[model samples]
Target: MHRFFISPQNIKENTVCIDQEEARHIEKVLRLTTGDIVVCFDGTGREYQVRLEGRENGILTGEIIHTGLRESEPALKLYLAQGIAKGEKMDTIIQKSVEIGVTAIYPVSCERSVVRLAGDKTEKKVHRWQTIAREACKQCRRNLIPEVMPVMNFTSLLEKIGDKPAIMLYENEDTNSLKALLQGEQFTGAKEIFILIGPEGGFSDSEVLAASRQGIVTASLGPRILRTETAGLVAASIILYEYGDLG
Candidate 1:
């Protein structure tokens, strides 16, 4: 069945009203009509089994047949604080991270970041990234859409994520692996996790030291260096697979 994410307001007593854009896709593109079944989620862990009622003036209405809780979301919440990369790489990272069950994403501006955004330009880019994340949630059947926060600088990110079991990926950090860290006594039943990945040039030494001082555990992703975009996604997948989700 086709899946879509809609706002809670779109859902009424026993009906779901899909607005123009999605309605057009169903009516004209998919050719789905009355009695056709589809699955819809409210992006808040609520899934509804719906049957099309009819379409009028670009609005497609459906009757909710059944509703249930979403089971696909990981038990652990994984947050990605990624340094802004060049071009479409950040887009790919956000999309894939959503597919892998990330709960939220924070686009951080680091010292080595290639892309810089400020004022109106930053707002536009954040909006674009959010759209990408929404589409990814729809495609991946995620019940909860991962939030893409407004861009933040490195220090601000650290301040916001204080005392969380945060992991900062560093190529030079050889003492600990994420897997090993998870197994240690310090980590147990940790529900909220923050994973930070640097940009194309990676984090500066001073930045790494600052993050370390804030208690963010710097870990390595094996000997081979992964690209800035690849590191976070790879680490997220491994972490989800090991501790909470990704079955």
Candidate 2:
């Protein structure tokens, strides 16, 4: 069945409204007729099995057949704090990370970050990435859409991390592997987990020290260094697997 993310307000007692781009997709592209079944979610961890009632005006409407909690969400709340990369790297990272079950994404501006977005441009970029995350959620059957936060400064990012159990992926780090860090520590009942990755030029020595001082563990993917885009996905996958969410 086709799945879509709609607003909670659009959902009535027994009816759901699909409008805007989604309405266009259903009416013009899919050409789904009345009685055609489609799954709809409101990004609130609930999904409704609805039957198309056809388009009314510019909006497409559907009758809710059943509603239930989404099961695709992982039990762990995994957050990815990624150093903003250049070009399409950030886009790819957000999309794939959402698919891999990241709860939310924070774009950090490190000393070595190549692409620095500010003011109006940062807002626009954040909107674009959020759209990518939503699209990825639709593709991955994720009931909850992960948020792509506005670009944050490296220092500000560390401050926002608070006292959460977090780890940073540092290319220079040789000893503490990701596996060893998780295995060595007991973080049971940790509802939230933060994973940080550097940009194309990687993190500077001072940034690593700052993160380390903020109680974030610096770990390595392995001896082989992965690109900025690949590092987060790998770390998130390993974390999810370790926590019993992935195989």
Candidate 3:
């Protein structure tokens, strides 16, 4: 069955109003008519089975057949704090991150980051990243769309995260591996797990020191150094797999 996300307010007692772009896609693009069954998610863990009732203006009304909680969410809440990469690389990271079950994403500006955004341009970029996240959710059948936070500097990112159990991925680190770190630790109840990945130029020595001081474990992804875009996704996949979400 086809699935699309809708806001909680759009859902009535036993009906859902599909409007805006989704309505256009259903009515014009897909050409789905009355009695066509579809699935709808509210992005808050609710999924509804419905059949189209009718169309008015640009809205497609649907009669709810059944409603239930989404059972696909991972037990661990993994947040990827990705250092800003150039152009399409950043987009690819966001899309793959969502598909791999990241709970949220933070675009960070490290000392070595090549891409920079300021003022209105920053807001637009963040909005665009969010749209990418939403689209990825739709494609991957994710119950909730991972949040794409506005870009931040390394120091600012640390301050915002406070004392969360975050790990920074570095090529030089030798003492700890991701699998070893999670062996005895209980991550089931963790509200947030931050995974920091550097840009193409990687994090500076000082930035690594600051993160280490804040207790963010610096872990190695084997001996091979992955690109900025590949590091976060690789770490996230391992996290989901070790935590029992990804098979």
lDDT of 2 by residue, 1-247 (tens): 8988899999989988886899888878988889999999888789899999877776789999999996998899999999999999999999999999999999999999989888999999999999999889889999889988878998898888989899989888888999888877555656789999989999999998898888898899998989898999999999999889999
In model 3, which range of ten residues has the least summed lDDT?
Answer: 183-192
Best by TM-score: 2
| Tens digits of per-residue lDDT for model 1, 1-247 | 9987778999989989997878878888999889999999898889999999996565789999999987888888889999999989999999999999899999999999988899999999999999899889889988888899999999999999989889999999999998898777666688878999999999999899999898888899999999988999999999898885776
Better of 1 and 2 by TM-score: 2
Of candidates 3 and 2, the better by lDDT: 2
In terms of lDDT, the poorest run of 10 residues in model 1 is 181-190
Per-residue error for 73 in candidate 2, Å, reads 1.6
Which of the predicted structures, 1 or 3, would earn the higher TM-score when compared with the native?
1
Question: TM-scores across all candidates?
Answer: 0.95, 0.96, 0.93
Cα lDDT, all candidates: 0.90, 0.90, 0.88
lDDT of 1: 0.90
TM-score of 1: 0.95
Candidate 2 ranges with C-alpha deviation above 4 Å:
186-189
Q: What lDDT score goes with residue 155 in model 3?
A: 96
